[model samples]
Target chain A: MPTMFEKIWNRHRVLEREDGQTLLYVDRHLLHDGTAPAFEMLRARGAKLRAPDRAFATPDHYMPTDTRRVAEIANPELREMVASLTRNAAQEGFTLFGLDDARQGIVHVVGPEQGISQPGMLIVCGDSHTSTHGALGALAFGIGMTEVAHVLATQCLWQRKPRAMRITLEGRLGPGVTAKDMILHIIARIGTAGATGHVIEYAGPAVRALSMEARLTLCNMSIEAGARAGMVAPDETTFAYLQGRPYAPADWDRAVEGWRALRSDDDAVFDAEVTLDAAEIAPTVTWGTSPQEAIAVDGLVPDPAAEPDAARRAELTAMLDYMALHPGQALEGLAVDRVFIGSCTNGRLEDLRAAAAIAQGRRVADGLRAWVVPGSAPVKRAAEEEGLHRIFLDAGFEWREAGCSMCLGTNGEIGAPGERIAATSNRNFRGRQGPGVRTHLMSPAMAAAAAVTGRITDIRTL
Target chain B: MERFRPVRSIAVPFARDNIDTDQILPARFLHLPRDADHGACLFRDLRGAPDFPLDRPQWQGARIALGGRNFACGSSRENAVWAMHGHGFRAVIAPSFGDIFAQNGLKNGLLPVRLPEATVAAMIARAEAEPSAELTVDLQAQQVIDADGVAHPFEIDPFARRCLLEGIDELAFTLSHEEEIAAFERRIGRENS
Candidate 1:
């Protein structure tokens, strides 16, 4: 009996390298502006890109679709990186989705929606969020720019086999309980470092009930748990999503056959197993320095003293200082200065709809700056067609263009020094948003409510 | 295939938890072309920051590093490892590592040691107190024998531990496993038929 990860990894295993590493032939390589400079070095060395068609590059990291100067950023270096990626992709004869091109969006979002991400494939990107592609039942993970260059030159990377783990959720989720909450609940159970060196395979009824969009949101946060990647097996739901997809086979018979074989056998073994009750999951929000420091929406701020571990105390204290939050304070009434609902993590149409619903008859609170940047042009168009943008804008939210805006502060969309924002972006580490800015992670809907009320308010109650 | 020379290097204080690749090399420098040899920029802003260890005067020029757990936490950019190696670090001593960064370190010949955080902290403190101190990191002995003869044992994955102890990087190790893998493949093929 074979697991999906095992099947994909085994199939991609080309030659074992001497160092106990498998020289895996990557099935797909997705590149963006921030990661292309390193590969551009290969051209400097006169080494041509080996597998042109197997690779793809796009300019999205620094693309600000809101501004007319999309091609030219204020930052000269970022501008060079975007231009270099566009040129390299062109010279290499690979698909280059430049700014102004409809395909120009987040690499992970663009890949799946464009039908480039397929099941049973091994995908690599230079972005940590590449794990988002595992929604297609692929083994995808982020690689470094050095490895990125090597991949462009050789179409392969040396990888060691990782242990497999399964996280099965039982029962049904309560109202407003989302895939974000599910993943957050799982992280809280496992801690930040729990999945340090494994590839997780999510299973069971709750996951099966999730749409492909929700599943992608779950896998996108695998990095927050310290996992190499996260995946879900394809079934009818997965095949149905891929039916008219640009890259999925058009023939229904072939799609059914492919989807049927995407599952793992019942007897397939996993290195570890964790079971969660879907009914127990609440609207989760994280506090402290790490994602694992999550608590229920109704829970109070964590007391580092209750942490028990000495090492955790110092870490918690550090976070307390950075965030300027005192111990034992309830997370509910904490005032937020900004709210950002964008990034590849939760910038889909469903995410926008969820946020828009909360903001429809509401307005952003005084002194709170709120913005909504869609993940892709298609997502933006779809949201606009549904008046989701109008709902957001009328609600005092600045509905903008598509890109990974306000995420990692790659573009100029960052927080003012010391200002705090409840962001839908994945990471909340100190200065992750800017030189001295703070980010509090939340669901897009939650972020919208936070923007409206200027505090951490439960979306369900709103 | 390579033209770099073996430069004798010393380890500075090790960065701990969530020491992202961006911190090692900021996102700003990421645009300088993949092979741009930006190792000099490793921990640039971090070192320049008033709070970073490198900003401290006493610990300057110390070789052999020690750190807390989860070093190099975020992205799997191999440039992070290369930047450290390029930054005159021969080895990094920590309790644990970001799994990807650890592999990247070994693949690129930046020796990563796994030790108790307390032991690593003690070593770092000792180096800070004595700038001329040299902590003899014997991979073969799996020990960081201090100048004062205080020895602390470290833990490592058996395979990665073996590779480093033998001073053999991943490439050499993969070459040695080729014969065994070929044999296993042949056996599996015959059995399947």
Candidate 2:
């Protein structure tokens, strides 16, 4: 009754120390601007990359998303930083998706889209959202810069095995609730640090029923819950998603056979298990700084004094203060100044489609700036081909190229001070959108609904 | 690569919970060179307030920071730790820390001391009461010495403790096993061949 995580982990183990640490071979290393330091460290040390073939590079985090020329990078230091990444990737012989490359996008999004993230693989990235690749049945997680350099110098990393936790999503989702909502609801049920020191494998009828993009979205935010990683077992759905992608194995049938074998035993046991009824979940929104400070659209902002734990109550008080929210106030119709429908968490094609479906033949509310950024260049091309871009543009939303824009305020995309934004991004941390900018995390469709109404509104009602 | 040694320094208390990396060193300032003076940017949004501990004259040149639970609780950006280090902080005492932040802190030679919530709260209260009071964190003995001469024992992973005391950076330690790693790779390569 071994869990799928254990099975994959056991296969990748190279050496085990007496202290219970294992040296596991990493199959792929996804790199982006956040990891430029690793290359700099390697260069400073005069060390050569040990396994360049296993590494992939891109600069999604630092690049301007609006087709600004590289020379127009206003900050000279940032321009140098982006240029050094391209130069280092070329010198190191790692496959790179520079800004001009058609394949350029967020590393987490591009990896799965290009089939570089596959089942039974051990993937690591410098970015915390690396857990998104686990939807393909891979054991993936974010590593710090030290680990990134270690992986670059050696295709292996030292890891203490994490305890297994199973989060089962039972039954079908209710109407208008999405994978984003389900994850938000889960984080709310379990506080931000609830899943610390564990690797979670999401299972059950509801999880298996989700599309590949939705499953990726579910795993993407696992870090927010403090889990080292989150994964879904590969099935026919996973195989079909990987079949024709650029980097998929040429021997497709054989690859599927191997992937078919990747599953937990029928009676697999976990150290902890939590079950959620999909029908109970709603279109969720965060009311406070942390992702866990969330509630359903119809729910009220929590009163901190009612909280039993003094520490949590204090945290809640701080969140309520920073978010400028009052106790017992209804969350619906809270005015928003901006709406961002992008991020590795919700910038995939399906995510854009959900937003476009709500935006089609509608106009954005006056004084609200709504922007739609596709997850990858391919996702951008596909959305344009299907006129999803036209729908968003027609609705008065700014349709932009692919990059991690506004999800983080770096790269010249920041909200003004005190501006409140309805965001489809993963984090709702205080000032995450911009300094003094309040963020309400929601699904893309919900963000779209808010964009059209200029306030937080339930997509179901719309 | 400086080896951690015993230090007794005044502790500046900032008791905010879940002070995420965004607040530690906002993404806007991360574009500056790593060696750029991030001390000015540390808590840039909250620094100017007279009530803020770091802005107070009594806490100037303090080498310790006391905070509430889940300190440094967001992104794996090492800049948060670097900024604190740049501000001359050697240790951050908290009830808890984000896992990634703790790891990054250890890598950067900054100590992230985890203590029980009440104990940390008491320490913070003491620091606030006596701004000139010094706390001595003994890495070798694994204890935090408070103003009342009480020693609070803290636990650390044995391996991490060794790394800090010996100044053994991750790269040097990882490269030490190069032969073993190369041999293992060769063995696997042969099997595939």
**Which predicted model would earn the best lDDT?**
2
Writing each residue's lDDT as its tens digit, candidate 2 over A33-64 gives 77777877777788889999889887888777
Model 1, DockQ value? 0.30
Query: How well is each residue in A123-174 modelled by candidate 1, as lDDT tens digits?
Result: 9998788889998899999876656776776667777788898999999888
In model 1 chain A, the worst 10-residue window by lDDT is A63-72
What is candidate 1's lDDT per residue for B1-193, written digit by digit as tens? 2212222234466545655565676554555554567667777755666657764676565444566767777766676776777655667888777777887776566767787767777766666566566777766666777667788776555666565545654434343445654454456446425
Judged by whole-model lDDT over C-alpha atoms, candidate 2 comes out at 0.88
List clash counts for every candidate, in order. Answer: 12, 0
Fnat (0 to 1) per candidate = 0.29, 0.37
lDDT on C-alpha atoms for all candidate structures: 0.76, 0.88
Per-prediction DockQ comes to: 0.30, 0.53
